[model samples]
Target: MLQTDDLTRYCDDHRQEALEELEAWLRIPSISADGAYRADVRRAAEHAAARMLALGMQRADVLESKGHPVIYGEWLGAPGKPTALVYGHYDVQPVDPLDLWASPPFEPQVRDGHLFARGAVDDKGQVVMHWEAFAAHLRTRKSLPLNLKYVIEGEEEIGSPNFDDFVARHRDLLACDVVIISDTPVFSEDVPSLTIAVRGLVNWEVHVDGPMLGDQHSGLFGGAIDNPINALAHIVAKLKDEHGRITVPGFYDDVRELEPAERAEIAALPFDETAEAKRLGVPQLHGERGYTPLERMWWRPTLDCNGIWGGYQGEGSKTIIPA
Candidate 1:
């Protein structure tokens, strides 16, 4: 077993080198969404695979998916001990509205203790943290206590379009006891925490088409047919009630009810309803009848109308039945 003191000493000595490596990685523009950056995305994947090889992993290979590539690395010497599979993405969000950035997104900088970059947090930085930590343990203790595997993908920013097929095709290669995701922030700097649950996503775009042809004057056909915008508004309003509970039937069937202890723990968190209301410009707070605001945010499922549009959105009003 490796001593804690040895681990600490190794990290302290190699910390600066680790930071430099992270900065170099941050320089790569691995934007998976845009086809132009596909080569850069592959380079990022190759860089991760190279690190795995350098860290003495038994197998380090870059697997090509239909879209952006995936890198898998493993050190499976410890037969009896449990194996850990780590997952992270090397791809970053597309940087648009370029003028808004105080510094270039790809050129990482450290100012007042925080690293500034596009992929620094979600999640090249997180991936590098895992890599450097493994390097330190190897550099100091010469071995990890258990078998470990890493799977860094380059398509997460685009919703991992080919990940399901990739995993199915290589199921045997990725078999492990537990999987860890390193894509989210720590709960707080002081009170370190692990996330046990997160809501699943279902994405879709709603387009409410009304008239068969183009725009007609509202005065001409106001009462002749149903207003698509009004219909959409009605549908959206019925999605939740005054108490904020989702109106969709059977939505709560799979929802795991939090125990009393869990509720108490959530309630103890620092909160001021009035202050939050003021900050949000909300007159008052509202949510599912029984749970506190914290529980609603953390555990409860929610529905939001992210985007909606139907007719003219210009300087002034143009009263027309737009399709």
Candidate 2:
């Protein structure tokens, strides 16, 4: 059986070939948000299953889902050891504003020692890393230290509409002692870290209905009518104050304050706010008041309107009170 050193040597020797395989997988335009790329999403799932089988997984197959398919793979030879369910996604977010891309979003490119692709970092790249590690163990050692089961889905980019149902139906099939996920970020390129906890999300959609049946002429009903768009803007503005404190009542009541040790741990991490701000091309940092950027990002609960639309949007002026 091969040792860790042997596996490391094998990986180092085949690094270029691994990169080529990753690039090939990255070429699939599996944008789950758009129905146009539904087939492409399935193709990505099939590719993942094929790769799992090639990596010597005892079982590798694509499972049906209400939305996009899920690829399940397992190697359960290590009896009595803890089973780890590896979770990852193959689907990617839609690439919009195509002109902004340095290269085609589907075409993976290496620039400045960074791989550039839509799902490269968010999930698919990390998924492939797990594959490589597992391959090393199976190919050289001929067995794993512990059982591993992978559940790579293709609808994560679309808010995982069918994921809950899928999980509910596959409870026994996915039973595991712990879950291993690589869908989060490290502190920085220099610091390889694991995320302990992640902030939960709650989404809401508020609608503003005007008296008019649809958009009305501004000349006829400008000041008299209450525009839904204007009302929405007012409501969104009231969510947070100028100081960046959320003004919504009871919004922070359940927000658990960070322990002193947790705060210290976060502070000890290498961070340069100035450099981060510069990298993001922002004039300065802004977020929930009285919290560090990292704290707000990793722990705080914040609200922002993702989308709001009900008005004329054209080159020429079409003044109207949108309904």
Candidate 3:
């Protein structure tokens, strides 16, 4: 086994270079969710492939998927050892509400010893961590202890629509004994935690159309009909009850009940409810009534409206009904 001090020192030696390269990669606004940023997303994929090639990977390429590209790299120098695949995403979420940001979303900043950037935590940072680790290993020992393969994608921010098909087609290329993921965080900085489950995602886009032939005056049609925005609001509200239980039938049908030991383990976790609320800037805590905050966060299923769009959004209120 490698000494922890030796590994720590090796990482420290390359930390600055790692930060610089990560900041350069982060500068590309790879917002896969927005069609306008398609070129930027492609650039991010190219960057990942290039980084892998620089790290002395045997084969590295940005293969075309039905949607954005998939970056694949491999280093199989170690024989008679287990092979591992590392999966990550180079694409980042759209940085909206620009006004609220203290620094430009794509520009990297170092303040208070933390790297400030759009994809810093949610994943460019994690990808860079993997990059630096492998780079250091290669530089120090000139070879890895075990064979490694990488399959980083560029359409993760959006629902990875074509990734399943792409993976199925390349099953032989992606075959591995195990896969490592770096997107989610451990429980806390000091606490060593491994995520065991991934919640399934179901996205719905609801468009409520009312009698707004362009911009109708609210004054004339106010009481005559139900506004689309109002109707949507009601529909969204009915999805969940006052006690935070989902009103949709069969929503919890497939959820496996936590065992008594599992519940006990969760209950014993060190968590401060008030500190969590304050960290989120919420006045108080609220969620599914029966479960504790930690349980609700990690174990319970939930329904949430991610984005909602309705009428006039401008500097001041426009009195016209929006479509």
Candidate 4:
């Protein structure tokens, strides 16, 4: 049996090596949304499976999916211990507007005690922390506090298209006493928090096609037809009220209201509106009335257009109305 001091030393010795391996793994461009990077995404998944096996997972494999592959691993040595399912994503967001990045998105860099990379905080870093914890336990001959299973999907950034189905199909394989996800932020830097509830999401794209069959002369057809761009703007403007409440019918019908004590608890959190505003580099904050910024971010539901474009987007002026 390994002693606690031996395990501590092992973790200290291997921490830097583990971080370097993480950086190498992050270098793979696993953008699942882009068809061109499909192979890279699979490569990343396979790499993750291998790493899990090396970390003492009894069964580790890339579970094929219609989209990207899912890396599954489990260490079930502790027979009587409770099982915990840990979920994370290996896929990353597409780095469009590449010029915005100070460094290449896939090139992990450490500066001032923080790692800057595409998947650093979003998921990879968080997932690696748990792996490190497991490695420490193993090195010390200390079994984990619970049976652990890792489900790292490769399409979370793309709405996790296959996740629900995979989970349903593998109910027995994924059975666990508790599910732990590290995708959320803590309440404060000093106070760690465990999230018990997650807000569900619904996404829709409103594509407005222009009336013109093709680009037409603006001088001739500009006033004759209702511009789709203008119509889209008007439609979006009608989605919210002056008080920032969504105008969609029945939008708030099922929304739950916080009790007086809950409201008080939320208000009691340490926050500075002015400091937050300064941090965001905004003159002031705006949101639904009667709620604090924390409440608005965590508890409130919101509606806003993620992207809108209808006119000529290229450089220089074009007098043609695009269809």
- lDDT digits (tens) for residues 5-82 of candidate 2: 988888998788778888888999999989998888889889889988887889999999898999999999999999
Worst 10 residues of 4 by lDDT: 1-10
Off by over 4 Å in 3: 212-215, 321-323
- Predicted model with the maximum lDDT: 2
Model 1: lowest-lDDT 10 consecutive positions: 184-193
Pick the winner on TM-score between candidates 1 and 2: 2
Provide C-alpha RMSD values for all models, in order. Answer: 3.1, 2.0, 1.6, 2.2
Worst 10 residues of 2 by lDDT: 1-10
Candidate 1 RMSD computed on C-alpha atoms after optimal superposition onto the true structure: 3.1
Winner of 2 and 4 under TM-score:
4
TM-scores of the candidates are 0.85, 0.94, 0.95, 0.95
* Residue-level lDDT tens digits of model 1 in 1-323: 73599889888888888888888889999999899998999998888788778867888899988888899988888889999999999999999979999899999999999999989999988988888888777777788778899999988877888999999999998999999998865655677678877666666787788888878889999999778898899999999998898999998999898999999887776678888789899998788998888788789988888678878889889989887
Error of 2 at 61 (Å): 1.3
Query: Residue 199 lDDT in model 3?
Result: 71
Cα lDDT of candidate 2 equals: 0.89
TM-score of 3: 0.95
Model 3 clashing residue pairs (backbone): none
After aligning candidate 2 to the native by TM-score, how far in Å is the CA of 148 from where it should be?
0.9
Error of 2 at 57 (Å): 0.6
